[model samples]
Target chain A: MIQVAVCGPRDASEAERAQAREVGRLLAGRGAVVVCGGYGGVMEAVAAGASGAGGLVVGVLSLSTREGANPHLTVAIPTGIGEARNAAVVNAGDAVIVVGGSWGTLSELALALRSGKRVVQLGGWRIADAEGAPLDGITRAGSPAEAVAATGLFV
Target chain B: MIQVAVCGPRDASEAERAQAREVGRLLAGRGAVVVCGGYGGVMEAVAAGASGAGGLVVGVLSLSTREGANPHLTVAIPTGIGEARNAAVVNAGDAVIVVGGSWGTLSELALALRSGKRVVQLGGWRIADAEGAPLDGITRAGSPAEAVAATGLFV
Candidate 1:
């Protein structure tokens, strides 16, 4: 099954979290496993959404314990390697869907760029500089459904 | 200086979240850097705690589009690599301290074990079963002070 990882805030606001879960739900409905860092914020919200929709959710945990993870996750992969687990999350996913924003989230984007994975950006921070946000040209979705549809072309 | 990484649960029931932050504070007191996936949960919480306690926090983000790191982070390593950003988190930390747990946390643990880095488990899920948990007979600390102290033996 294709894994669609939703990377974003760990303490996301209610609205952003809702958006993340909706994205997970739609992706899970498409039979994709929704993957995340697996704790709170976007991870928990997305897992809840996907699991609510009867989709498989996988958590790429950085700890050796299970203190973190959504109640819906089907599999737990222990990287025992700290941030290196991000690679596992990115590698497992066929496509990358980033939401909200964070430094770790940005790193995930870099991984996607390096891995050549299908990338999509949802509501979050933007990568801007003197040359405007470069990601402005990349795949950007305004809603969960649009993000789902946008992924169809990538897969 | 030691480097510790914490991941899992943003709104982790106040108490749980408190413990994560306390761990970070303890680590930071030793002039160690708190490295994390760098968003929220134990990651942001600990980063906040560490920075509040005058410790350096480096956020190894996984996306480039979003660099919204926690307020405590001193350095934002924007990794525009998607999930591949996990590798940077583990590599950056000198001693990886795991608090709470999740699949992403687990994957990080796996990478740490694969790299043979000194790992300290405060509390969380079990990564191994029949093969046994990585770092068998490893020192498990209940408090952040002990966890940081334990890190000294390895590095």
Candidate 2:
């Protein structure tokens, strides 16, 4: 009954793209809708994998002018908010699954922090300062499977 | 020296991809560092365009586990936070530009609104009113030139 939101770099590297797809498969196999920024890289890979299994995929786009939605997306929630569309993803997910990322990834982590949502970091860079003020309710997993499993157990 | 972030669905249709690439070129020619989810679709397009023009591009990635960074990224800020990466994108940009989208894009949009970032929707849906309250300073543009102009004027 919960949706798993996948967020990552739009121009993800090969390995990142592969990881995202695997994660999507895992989520879809469990019958969760896959949500993402929705154009390419990690987002597209995940959507492609999930949709291949007959899973529903949602995309919240930021195009204010002419950009269009990804073809893999089943539902498109357009937010005329420009790049701020990131907020909707963090909020929509019951649990957050992160794959390969950059700055956008960090912000989504922050959103999870702000929302008190369950956050599981897979394989990427350490964005927060654990030594300083550790994030509350955030758990770090060694792999994608571990990350998704924690969603059922943790938040 | 303001940074502008752009993102969208990864598995974009041909039309979305073309539009994203054009947006990337426009952003680069204007001398702005285009930030993105950092892997594919609009992220790669914007980063390639900006980097090619000697402009700066930063990618905030979510792969703390093992995913790699995009080749076009000049500066990669890996968060290892996974889907929460959306929050990072909204936080990093000085201003925001949106184009085609998905769930992650919506999350970014929500984060931008919460952060009070000025956003210019480019070619997708307009930011909807939340609980009957409209965003305070969102701008609408129909073309890349107008969108960029709006970002400049709004910021």
Candidate 3:
């Protein structure tokens, strides 16, 4: 199964949280493993969605305690590297789907782009260059279904 | 001298590059040392500006090779931790000044905020919460001078 990272903030709105959950559910339903930052908000929502669907959920935590992860995670990786673990999350995912806006989401987007990984934005940052040109290959999806479909994982 | 991190993309535009340079010079003029991702683009520009002003600059490179740092850096520390080295940049800086927008810049901002470090945005992200309130204490400056001054390091 392909690992899909659903990244966003720990304090997102309810709509954004719902979007993340749907994304997680869709990805998991398609036999894809879901990965997240392993904290609250969107992470918790994603983990809960995947777990509710009996899908494998991995939490790459910045803290050193497995208990630090959301209760839905099937596997918890405590890196104790703080925000640096963002790299580990991106590296572990086959593709990354950004659910909403946050500095951490932006970082994951940057790393994914730099590494030439497939990046899909559900409702987050649309970064561009100084000339107003899109720097990396960033795809925008209007819905969770489109976002997971765009990943081409199920195909 | 205080250590300030000047973070942005390695592929910044000419204007953003110039902005980074001025930021570096301003920081150095105040007897402050500059730190960066230690690659190209804004990092190189900041290092150049500081080195030209006879100020000290440290490049915390993501690569293990010291040669990966820009030539303008006075000291090079290669972590080989990939993008994870962003944690090192934030930890080494007494404060951080974001010169432009990028995924890497966004990550640094998040990490700095989480750690409760002083963050000054020159021309980068303007992050807000779900309620449209500033999530963290983000200081915005119109010019590089104002940005560096707002850091309150020279005070």
Q: Rate the local accuracy (lDDT) of all candidates.
A: 0.70, 0.70, 0.84
lDDT of 2 by residue, B1-155 (tens): 76788866665666666666677677777777788988777677667777877778888887763255668888888777666577678677888887765445645755675577878775553332212233356576777677777877333
What total of clashing residue pairs does each candidate reach?
70, 89, 0
Interface RMSD of each: 14.8, 14.7, 3.8
DockQ, structure candidate 3: 0.36
Off by over 4 Å in 2: A65-68, A130-136, A153-155, B1-155
Q: What ranking of all candidate models by TM-score puts the best one first?
A: 3, 1, 2
> What lDDT is reached at residue A152 by model 2?
80
Model 2's alpha-carbon lDDT is: 0.70
Better of 1 and 3 by lDDT: 3
| Candidate 3 backbone collisions, by pair | none
User: Which model is ahead, 2 or 3, in terms of lDDT?
Assistant: 3
lDDT of 1 by residue, B7-112 (tens): 5544455655787788888877777777887777788888878888988888888678445667778888878865556566777777677776544564465455
For each candidate, give its TM-score against the true structure: 0.52, 0.50, 0.87
Q: Over the stretch A24-77, how does candidate 1's per-residue lDDT look in tens digits?
A: 888878888888888789888898899899999889997877776667688877
Tens digits of lDDT, candidate 3, B47-73: 999989989999999888886678998
